[model samples]
Target: MRFFRAAYAVAWKDVLLELRRKETFTAMFFFSLLVLLMFNFTLNLDRTQVLSLAPGLLWLAITFTGVLGLGKGFLAERENECMDGLILSPVPRGAIFLG
Candidate 1:
């Protein structure tokens, strides 16, 4: 279908860009690891203390990593002005947005 083709094109474009740059994954990995480590340090790790803090630590890492990764996603689009090109496309805006 035409819609599916366009969607694949956009996804493939992004995949190629990411493959060449490799910055986004590296940043996300390091940022996520740093968040996990920070949570561990602040909790004052110990046998008794560690068990109670597990959920809180995991949740904090997920929240922070998600926020950080989302920010980077926005930045990547902005950095190359890809958003502007997307906005100018003839396709339905919602489809572009969802992509």
Candidate 2:
């Protein structure tokens, strides 16, 4: 229960910070669109080409956007030194890394 609460609190904190800043989602969305466009332009996304490359394109977009989102996800904690606070909370280091 305590672990669950902590997880929920951390998630809620992230959501609230994102709501206030609004830049993370905006940047991620724009970057994803750019990636999609690049895939189309460079790969020549015709039906046959798209069929073959579609999985790669989709996964590439997801991976890139996930990386973007990951960087942005830490924005609030970095700004407010929340990472230090989290570390002091007794959670295992591996859990923090996974988080």
Candidate 2 per-residue lDDT, tens place, 2-38, comes to: 5666666677777787788777888888999999988
After aligning candidate 2 to the native by TM-score, how far in Å is the CA of 42 from where it should be? Answer: 0.5
Superposed Cα deviation of residue 98, candidate 1 (Å): 1.5
Candidate 2 segments whose C-alpha is farther than 4 A from its true place: 90-99
lDDT of 1 by residue, 3-45 (tens): 6666777777766776776777788778878888877777677
User: How do all models score by TM-score?
Assistant: 0.67, 0.78
* Top lDDT prediction, candidate number: 2
Number of the top-ranking candidate, with TM-score as the measure: 2
Model 1: CA > 4 A from native? 1-12, 45-56
- Scored by Cα lDDT, where does model 2 land? 0.79
Return model 1's CA RMSD, one decimal.
Answer: 2.9
Task: Name the TM-score of candidate 2.
Answer: 0.78
